[model samples]
Target chain A: MSTQTDTRSSAVVAGSFEGDPRRYLRGLGGLLVFLLVWWVGAMTTQPSYLVPGPLDSVRAFIDLFATTTAIVVPVSGSDLVLPTGLAHLTETLFHYVPGLLLGASCGVSLGLAMGWNGALDDWLRPLVRVLRPIPPLAWVVFAIVWFGIHHTGAAFIVFVGAFWINFYGAYGGVEGVSTDLTDAASTLGVERDLSMLKLVALPSAAPQVLTGFRTSIGRCWMIVVGAELFGAPGVGYEIINASNNLAMATSVAYMFLISLAFLCMDVGFRLLEGRVLAWR
Target chain B: MALSSESSVDRESREKITVRNVSRAYDSTQALEGVSLSVGEGEFCCIVGPSGCGKTTLLRAIAGLDDPDGGSILVGGDPVTGPGLDRGMVFQEYALFPWRTVRGNVRFGLDRPACDCADCEARVRELIDLVGLDGFEDAYPKELSGGMKQRVGIARALAPDPEILLMDEPFGSVDARTRDRLHAELLDIWAQTGQTVVFVTHDIDEAVTLADRVVVMDAEPGSVQSTFSIGIERPRERTSREFVDYVARIRDELGSPIDTIE
Candidate 1:
């Protein structure tokens, strides 16, 4: 096992970012290939009701963009969106931003707290076990009742999906910090609170936090759709509206946008992770 | 038992550290029971023993990294309760922060408000230069060799000019060649600074070569088996008869004097 790991590390070191092109271009190429396959398969399908071609979806998107003049949730029955494309995107962003910020922040804090304290970690483990099994969608009813069809309703869904992953990531990162670093700090006379955390704890846990943060971002995208399905306005709502009106092409168009958004976020996250973890 | 023995060593260089009957245990096992030792200011003392003999626990207590269930350690005549700035430590692993550069690691001890005086920067630079890391100040621990990282560790420990330096097998992790080079550097640093150093090692040669007095501790429930004062002069030859005799003496104490392991 050790030999295998050593071989893998040496291989990685030998070719690690050395004349490699696993950059944005690779991501774009994959995206284009996926879309091309999707496009071809859609064109070939005998019954296009379930799968509209990319061109057909775009046509419906343009028509929806040009025609929309007012907006609300698909369930709200306030049909026409004012200058539709941007408006719907902005509405989705509103829910996503709040959820992402609140959920990620709280999750990170909880993870740090739990990882640092053994008592808290042991106490919360069983609680997390119980809470984690409950799907984020189970909270939709409470989301609607408590938030009443607002962005908060959508945000709650996203938060549920994201919070636990980040919490656990942060916990693992903090717990894995090298005892040597702590010993070094103690010897150097750094016995204070903030200094200890900054010097020894946080930096040590960074890789774990980044992994958790990245994982949470993916979960947030999933939860946003669940949020939209329940009474919140988003790209999901646009799809729901187009479907009920029997405009399957527009529904496909909305879905395309959701996929595009998630793809863009994953790419952005990888870049940020690379930059932050770079030791210099 | 060992503590009182050290207090009365009485070859004064100002009595910086005084240990009093310090005992430590883990669950049912005693690592150190009724163990005590002291170091006068400017003394180079080495604690040598077999593995699991609580040489480390003794060093930890002096640094306040571990608390003795009984007795106390007085650093510059103040009782030690917990880890503090008065004592500096160098671990076997070097313990340099992986994320920080060599200079950054050294600056850790220098960050205290007390150390932030006008001389702090110069003091840090001098130690950095003293450790022979003149050009690699900006290099992080990951980029460094084992010996280099330990140099950073040593430099950081010395940056604050603490009254005592508590080293726990600090050179144990380095290669033999690097360890030899570092041993010379450490002795030179000790001669110049006169910092009270309490170094622990299992290697008898290291204990004899670097110490004014090598305190030998027995295994299991570690006790100070004997203290051998090296009367040999500076730049002592490891190949010489005197050096071999010192190693032989410690070797004899470990088993039957008649049939001891080399």
Candidate 2:
């Protein structure tokens, strides 16, 4: 019996080490290996311009922060100079934050309402089904027509992309709430329909709703970059401009910047989610 | 015992529950049929039966969580229309909200318009202490054991100070030792509060152990088979001949084939 217990304890110890930290270390190792192979490939290539090394990309990234661009102020007709990196990044965030906030809030509210209320679900489901299939980029022409070639137009496109993801998230969350929970609340004197929804249904659906929020955060970042590809001043536009000018290293640098920004946002959101769902 | 043969009119005046000709059906299955029983004020009544028996259905109907197809259920001389604050129920699964802390779950029912803030807080704290969960008030439901979770369930049910406490197989999930402890605690609470309790269970020993009167029920259109009064006093010895006799009688009435086979 003691020997069997020792074997079981050893197995448990082995199982614990097999998770999380080891997996993270393996991921980091794989990334380093990939970078090494890319660097080697770049050195072996025929021309340096075709495949700039990792060091060249890092230099280009630094240059973006140092470089300034001169633009004529539209309203004042004055020469205004700004760092290209800061200006483009600020422009992207201006649209991205407001658009994501607006779309996510509206979508979650509507989705929860529709999921909770049978009448609202019947009224809105068909319209949503018809509209959901049309891609957000398809609204670019309409956005440009309505808001013109400005921040609002780009924001509108990003909103369209984020809205659908949040809508589905909240809808599924509310639908997934077990009937047993609602009955429990009813016995606890939360019998009114509105109160039941508020007290029981909403909290029960929070994990799924938060999952929707997290997913939309990643999705909005992707959409914002795509939205900026069309005459909008963001990292995506910088990448296109650099590649067009045969500065492939600069293009790759901007791509890395976008990825870094996404990683920061994703990690931050995951931490917040962990704190909120600590009970689970 | 003398109260059992009293007319409906006289019994209704003093009894906490007067379930008369109550019947319920789910689609094609007759869950309950013409079930009638009366529980006196502050009486501890346990309904025992086999699987497929409509004990849970009857308890749910009494709690006003479900509606009966026919007949009337009266609590304190009023017809049970729907779920109200006057009836508190403890579920078998210990349905304490996962997100809410022990205090928060207990406070759920106390946040009504009828209860003042200070009084509600005091009552919640009192119940937390009464259920032997004073130190763990801030702990979430997931952090608790099966027995501890059911204690939270009891505390949450008692928070509103309801007159009628309905428990459906509340200790069925707990181990025997934990269940024994819970039974003692529950009886103490019941004696202190003077609340009418209608407990449903499949375990005959459990019914005999906890109930003042053991109500035996038959399945397949579930109806009351017979009623046995347990005159044995509090903290009743499980090994006592009287206790064993009560358990055996109830088991026999419940149609347990173990005794017959032996």
Docking class of 1: acceptable
Q: Model 1 chain A: which ten-residue window has the lowest total lDDT?
A: A1-10
Model 1 CA deviation exceeding 4 Å by range: A1-40, A54-83, A118-126, A193-195, B1-13, B114-119, B256-262
Q: What is the TM-score of chain A in candidate 1?
A: 0.80
Question: With candidate 1 superimposed using the best TM-score fit, by how many Å does residue A86's alpha carbon deviate from the native?
Answer: 3.5
lDDT tens string, model 1, A140-164?
A: 8988888876787888877877788
Residues B140-232 of candidate 1 have per-residue lDDT tens digits of: 677667778788888888888787888999988777877888888888787666678999988888888898889988766877888888888
DockQ metric, candidate 1? 0.32
TM-score of 2: 0.90
Leading candidate by TM-score? 2
**lDDT digits (tens) for residues A98-120 of candidate 2:** 88888888888988999999999
